[model samples]
Target: KEPKEQGDAKEQGNDDNSTEEPVTAISEDNVKDQSIPSPTPPTPPPQ
Candidate 1:
């Protein structure tokens, strides 16, 4: 019974670790996309 419990815990840990990397990669990509320069604002019309 102890061995079975240990195996289940290890499997859950592995699943959690596998999901973390992709989340980190997507977050990094979002940061990079946001860093790009945007178009300049148009000049205000004369008053």
Candidate 2:
């Protein structure tokens, strides 16, 4: 019984870890995709 319980706990831990990589990858891609520089400030009217 103890061994079965341990196995179940380990399986659940692995499942939690498995989802982290994809989420991290997606967030990183989103940041990279928005790397464009902000638009230049509008030029002031000629003095």
Candidate 3:
């Protein structure tokens, strides 16, 4: 039952993920542009 519930939740999350992706894309583009010279994406993920 627990496993089934988690599976359903993950499946449902995929539907909502599209809406969330644009926000992330905007942020990623902004960060990529600002830190083009530096590797902030990798650096921030670690910290």
Clash count for each candidate, listed in order shown: 0, 0, 0
The window of 10 residues in a row where model 2 has the poorest summed lDDT is 38-47
For candidate 1, the TM-score is: 0.50
1-47, model 2: which lDDT tens digit per residue? 99999999999999889899889999998877666322222333332
lDDT per model vs. reference: 0.79, 0.77, 0.86
Cα lDDT for residue 10, candidate 3: 96
Model 3 stretches with alpha carbons more than 4 Å out: 1-16, 37-47
lDDT, ranked from best to worst = 3, 1, 2
Better structure of 2 and 3 per TM-score: 2
In model 3, what lDDT does residue 13 have? Answer: 96
lDDT of 3 at 16: 89
TM-score quality measure for candidate 2: 0.51
Candidate 3: Cα lDDT at 33: 88
